[model samples]
Target: MSSTEDTTAQSSIFKDCLARRVIAQPALSDTPDASSSSSSGSDLDEFISYLASEVWETLPSQLRALTHEHPVIDVDADALSLATIPGSFTDTLVSYGIAADPDSACDFLRSVLRDYVDEARAPPPAWSSTRTSECEICERDVPLTYHHLIPRSTHTKVLKRKWHPESLLNSVAWLCRPCHSAVHGIATNEELAREYYTIELLLTREDIQKWKKYASKQRWGVRRG
Candidate 1:
């Protein structure tokens, strides 16, 4: 077999073996190891980081199934894997306000998750269409637009997950002109689909907040990230 084929075969075997091992083993949760809990602070941090990465990695599949949009995106990726979609990823990243470089995309996605936890503790104000509302992130009273937690571009991924897609379409937040522009400026459609799509998640990014604050105060112009 070719090298690529050989690698695929090996991966399949590895997964199968892992499945068999899991099937034969007792649940670790039921027999927790004391040493596991007693791990060093650095070790704990590493594990938590790994866990978050894994969650983002697998989120697209979940989104496809849950959102129930049609033509479900069959490609595999998470926020960290945005570089995989090179041409489109780079284009969208630049349009969204972030630098269109592999290093920049990877670095941004890696650190964005921690912001979500902070958002949970102190949520931003929800966007309203009927009444004037400040930008949720910058607190600027600029005109706001509906920002999808899952970009409309990702409706296909949603179709993959859900039996119905209406709920996903209905879910969105409001962002002021500059903040909204900034969001699209910093992240790609795939990245938004997989992570950093929610209002709370967005609020936690101090870097984005800095952008918003600067934009809100600047009369001349709002710069993209």
Candidate 2:
């Protein structure tokens, strides 16, 4: 098949996979016996095979080269941006309404190829020794911790009660240790999940701002009270 035909087939299968997951049905993994005479099943398997082999060649060469070296698709911010920006295979797909945007594309691809991708496309907002990054809150050049916007502790209850969408469960903020402590100190997990999920929303509080200002000045390794 041609590249466009291959991409269109892949996108359709991917969308079907996503829809099946949403409604709690088996998607791509279902197989049909040769005697079953299920054309749709046979076609799906063909597209899946194409995905395993030829899909990489359909992508932008830079992205293809990048993923070729890594066992898992590491979709950092820049890579995610390329999905919506001009001149990318994902952009073309988005233009055709195959997915909403980068986030949606990531979700669709992740769901469709669950084993090949990480659980989450974005890295957890924590910092480490060799790859330390600045805190999202205090902007401190310190070790950071991953603060789940909707605390994992509350996920079951939240979903059970239909309090929030499943997508928000994995949303996160990268904070320095003290700032991280101050956030949980000021609000309950439920409150954080509902009202203070975003950094912009969290920064609106005087207490959090005060904490940021104070914590930003402190050197690394200073613990919060």
Candidate 3:
């Protein structure tokens, strides 16, 4: 067999052996092993850092542009990895059938990253003509657009990784055009999807608060540069 085929065959055998070992093991109590937990957590962090280094630059420019409250273009791989996604990292990997080995973990992460990009590029859901009584951010009576609290771009990975409940994917906020633009301008889609998936959380940021104050004063028909 070719080298690639040989590697694939070996991987299949490894997974089969691992599955059999798991099936033969007795079920443990609900409590987890502290030492094993710590080790797995460390492994997850290392894998994320390595995967960030491998794929950070290749991420879409918009994906790399902003994080929670800061520009992330120059952020190091460690920080990028931490801010990229949220979940019980080790558990998510096992649930996805990704092996604990670094090579296997990184390979899975790369595919996840590709899915993230594809989702980010996908067209957003059709906007509803309905407008809330006011912008949730600025509290102004104006024409509003739907701002997905959990951004649509991260929907695929979020569901795949079980990071957030599926119901939360359809949650949204009504924001005036300016407020909606500011939301995207302030943070990347991943940040919005992972961290600021609610108006309360978004308002917690001082920057966002400042923008709300400024936006509230502007006339409804005014366009911001």
Candidate 4:
């Protein structure tokens, strides 16, 4: 078999082995071994740092330009807060890449945070209906246009790698027209612009679902009276 085919076969086998092991494990809520835990944590940090660096490198030139315009602050502390937490970043990393092991991935992320704490800056605020009028890129009120946090180009580039549509949307943001133009370029490329709109439509579905849940809660609340 070809090298690619061989690799795929091996990966499938490994995944099957892991699944079986998980099924076999007894429920253990007790504390884990300290040394093993620490070692695993360290591995996670290394993996996170590697992944973050890859992401940074993969960003579009326009997006990178914006970051360059802004000052870089220590990100280690914030990274720790985001990385250690059992949510978005951790989930994204694991889903995007087949981590060697889960515990090791977690630990490596922590160490990565520690190393880059000083270099990290707070991300720009998210854009929503309330924030749409404001420019996300420049924080000004200039006919803001939604900018994809993860550009369509980037998404397409990474599509070959394992990633879900929902995870892709979670990684993007909205920006103003000028800022969007500035980041992308002055030429109005209709096709490229359309891709962004498509992603927005996908994200809208999420908003609608949230609204539906909220409305259900409100209706239930009223019915309880």
Candidate 5:
């Protein structure tokens, strides 16, 4: 038996699915898996395939041809743009009859990809050094993030306290991750500084409560347009 024959005999029966193709990795430790490009809510591969498939509509001859060659391929964040939509992708879209203007479809894909990239790159929000990890307002056992009671942008005019490095962190409120994002979404920095600066004051706002309720329904960070 030759080397090729020996290798084929030894290799585990190959499966068409991704789990078979990917090198079995240890469960991610302390960080998310960066190797896979797929995202939970928005699937890039399926979207492209759907556009090319006959199930949606008949694609143009050119796009249909591309389906066989580049059915699904991984694209990086930098390549997610109107200018960068590969020829194969454009062909696939046209073949599926989904391309009214190829540029329009490309723009939509870019926006969706940009959203995913933003999520992947987002840094964890920081909390005030003075406060414990637990939220000061909701008292939930969640990740803590700092809330600027006076809003850091106010620093442009004058310092809220003595200008130590931790001065801003020291002066801020300790809030749960949800609450911190909620507070900023509802009220502008000026409003937060002038009107709602304390737990009692912030908790009473109807907007904050509404935001909290809205956030609870979302699967991730916050529901955005």
Candidate 6:
């Protein structure tokens, strides 16, 4: 064959190979498997429903009112905003028994809101005000501020934005001032984010109670009483 013809043939073969490779690569916008997505979502819904019946069934009667009034879907927005924030909130929600099903997630949130409203109606507990409280860390006897165990800034952007305020509240814990500051500092330092994340992930009511006991012991410099 002529050199010119040979070169053209080689170029055509190279183009064909490149086209095949491109086609074999995954499509960025390929439609998700609707059946699989729906099934997974359904399972999540069942889980959330079970959680609601188990964990929230005994919540105060007043708290139930909050859930009954709130709608499941956001009225102003056309779509949920789950894509913009950290996955921890979502993961925690699921971990705490929020179902993957939209309806189940909504019901769980409704119950949570009811609890918040009930809490709001009652007189603030003695420990609610920070001014008279002691720090959980640093052994300082100083005024306290409510520290959201899961940072409010992060939570609002993630769970509340996607779900409701009540759901966020049920998922959080109150921290004394020093511990709050230390945790925030830890969270801010990139080197410590993982540790802070783990702390938040592992936190439970028992852990909070234990921390409070430790703080109380430190404050008095003695065991109970």
Which predicted model would earn the best TM-score?
A: 3
lDDT per residue as tens, model 3, 1-225: 354543333232222222222212232111132124223333323333333344444444445332222333322232334334333443444443443544444444444443333322333234424553889998998667788999888999888988799989999888865567567756789888888999999999755764564455444532111
**Whole-model lDDT values for every prediction:** 0.44, 0.51, 0.51, 0.35, 0.41, 0.35
Pick the winner on lDDT between candidates 1 and 6: 1
* Tens-digit lDDT track of model 2 for 1-225: 454543443343333333333222222223222123333234434433343343444434433322222445543522433344334544533554556676665565544444223211223333444436889887977667778888889899889988789988899887764466567767898898778888999999855654454345444532111
For each predicted model, how many residue pairs clash, with residues at least 3 apart or on different chains? 18, 0, 0, 29, 5, 4
Q: Per-candidate TM vs. native?
A: 0.37, 0.41, 0.42, 0.22, 0.37, 0.23
lDDT (Cα, 0-100) at 54 in candidate 3? 45
Which runs of model 4 end up more than 4 angstroms from their true locations? 1-132, 162-166, 186-225
lDDT per residue (tens digit) for residues 73-190 in model 1: 3232335365433444334334434434656645443333222222112222343335367767767665466678788877787678663356656577777544564576567877
* Model 6 residue 93 distance off true place after TM-score fit, in angstroms: 43
Model 6 spans with C-alpha error above 4 angstroms: 1-142, 160-166, 170-174, 189-225
**Candidate 6 clashing pairs?**
44-100, 45-101, 63-114, 130-144
What range of 10 consecutive residues in model 2 has the weakest lDDT sum?
Answer: 115-124
Q: What is the lDDT of residue 176 in candidate 4?
A: 41
Error of 3 at 223 (Å): 9.1
Tens-digit lDDT string for candidate 6 (124-198) = 336543354445443456444455544545654445355334444434334443245334432343323223333
Compared with the true structure, model 1 gives a TM-score of 0.37
The alpha-carbon root-mean-square deviation between model 3 and the true structure, to one decimal in Å, is 18.9
Question: Can you write out model 5's per-residue Cα lDDT over 17-132, one digit (the tens) per residue?
Answer: 11111111122111122123333312322332333332112222222122212333233423345554556655654554444467855754443333323332335443333334
Cα misplacement distance, residue 50 of candidate 2 (Å): 68
What value of lDDT does candidate 1 attain over all alpha carbons? 0.44
**What lDDT score goes with residue 184 in model 1?**
66
The deviation in Å at residue 216 for candidate 3 is 0.9
Please give the distance, in angstroms, between residue 160's alpha carbon in candidate 6 and its true position after superposition. Answer: 8.0
